[model samples]
Target: MTNIEKKVIDVTGLSSDQIAMLEEIVAALKAVSQTNNYQGKVSLDRLEETPQPSLTLEQRRAFLQLTLEERRRLLAQQAENMVEHYQENTEWQEFLAGGIIEY
Candidate 1:
């Protein structure tokens, strides 16, 4: 795999809540991925065995940094039953939590 360069995230424009939410999502995903109940494509054992190409902090933050309108779209797309679906869809949940709706 190709290596990705790391850079600092310019979070100056983000509100405290947004930053907190972004961090919260990443931590939640990682934590859930470690759980025995996790039913995602990638297992905890596999994760531990693999040298994954992790995203830079800036890249993760940038991926999650969405405009207000974008947030609205995500909400609309996932406002109801989607959360239930996300519980089983690890990748989509992570993407949604990162301000991306993979549809």
Candidate 2:
């Protein structure tokens, strides 16, 4: 069998929670992946339209001001989920590599 097929066959035993976490990671990865090849300026107008929780002005501003480093650290937490998912379902390795999920 091909390497990816072999990997998928190997990952059939994942727990439900593990699968869910992998899905979440995949979503986050997709969101950040655009940065890898960005060539145009990003606008904040869309962000301004999105409704957030009932934070005070200061709290909202603070959250908006988070540094890229801080965002990366937060995003890295998704890796923990990815690892757990992989351990539970070895076949997920293929999913990760295929962009079906995140690595």
Candidate 3:
């Protein structure tokens, strides 16, 4: 295989569809980085210094009104939904089969 073809298949065990999607996402990120003149360094310290929208007191109060159990249940449901969504992708099933380690 040519180097281009070899690079495309570097991600072992993924379906062709998954590889195509991955390539598209990678291309998009590369385009964004080039257009924005980004050096590709990911630093959360810079992000922390960026101004973020603040929640109003009422909005904060409403968000905090959920009981701990209610919050946990909501979080669990969201997690389940995300897992199900990923599970529908054959590539994700292969990833899960290999197991994932979270940092």
Candidate 4:
């Protein structure tokens, strides 16, 4: 039997088909991991959960005092952070599985 090699991947740049391929590989791993003592399952629930953040009083005050340009830069950074965590829509999974989600 061959060993499975795993690597840390940046999923943000992966297309939907690449994401689907990863999912199928994971499912196969989980199936093989089952034995007399254990059954493995993975949850993708966080895909739908939105992040919740609360600022401390000092942080809020600092944010409020930022100049317009500084605020724009900060907001742009925050938006990019959010987009980096975005989930692929479910409807595209089938198309993705075929490895050609787009023409």
Candidate 5:
């Protein structure tokens, strides 16, 4: 028999339906992988283009002197900034309005 026929005979145990189902699964996995790869590439490009902040040693020291409440407030503000940076819907607005974030 031909090489193609030989290969097909080797897996003759799998019905035609099984082969088709396997192909469908493989195609779906490939599509998902391609999408994930594209997203990862875009994320990497964005990260590379984003500027890194530089802080002086004195500024870092002063930041460390903040009280726990002050630190929480600063962190919440930073979270808000990140949300705005990504243009994400604000889910923390209610929490902020509730005054759960101490200043």
Candidate 6:
């Protein structure tokens, strides 16, 4: 078999959806390499219009009243959910926490 097929065979544990995403990335990279100027848009479509765990005024007040550790746990949970759904990492935890704390 060819090297590309062999490399693909070596990959493990990715779902079909993940593989599809990687293939799309590879195609985009190839396009950029060939043309030297990719016109592709970087989409924020993955970031929904509404934030997750949307809070009402009362809910926001209650969340603001939570102790720092409690707030951290909630942010961690949200980060975990994001990781599960979007392959996003926990690095976003601090950023989210900052937004909530500053509000």
Overall lDDT per candidate, in order of appearance: 0.51, 0.43, 0.45, 0.46, 0.44, 0.44
Error of 6 at 41 (Å): 21
lDDT of 5: 0.44
Please provide, for model 3 over 5-103, each residue's C-alpha lDDT reduced to its tens digit, 9 standing for 90 to 100.
Answer: 122225677677555555554454345334433222234667432232444554344435544664565457546645654554355456568646766
**Tens digit per residue, CA lDDT, model 2, 30-89:** 444433232122235662222222434544344344446644664465465455544654
TM-score of each: 0.29, 0.27, 0.30, 0.35, 0.36, 0.34
Alpha-carbon RMSD, each predicted model: 14.3, 18.8, 19.8, 19.0, 24.8, 17.9
Tell me the tens digit of each residue's lDDT in model 1 across 1-103.
1112333556698899777766664465455334423232354555532333455676456446766664565446434434544565567555567644546
Worst 10 residues of 2 by lDDT: 1-10
Candidate 4 stretches with Cα past 4 Å from truth are 1-53, 87-103
Candidate number with greatest lDDT: 1
lDDT, candidate 6, at 87? 41
Error of 5 at 62 (Å): 0.5
lDDT of 6 by residue, 71-100 (tens): 676567545544453443343555666654
Compared with the true structure, what per-residue lDDT tens digits does model 5 show for residues 1-103? 0011111213367677555554453354345434433221224445443233444454445455544665566567555545554454333454466765669
What shift in Å separates residue 36 of candidate 2 from its native position after superposition?
4.5
Q: Ten residues in a row with the worst lDDT in model 4?
A: 33-42
Best by TM-score: 5
Q: Note the residue pairs that clash in candidate 6.
A: none
Which residue ranges in model 5 land beyond 4 Å of their true spot? 1-50, 88-103
The deviation in Å at residue 64 for candidate 2 is 26
lDDT of 1: 0.51
Q: Extract clashing residue pairs from model 2.
A: 11-91
Residue-level lDDT of model 4, residues 20-71, one tens digit each, is: 6555544543454333111111236653433334444545455555446655
Query: lDDT value for candidate 3?
Result: 0.45
| N/CA/C clash count, model 3 | 0
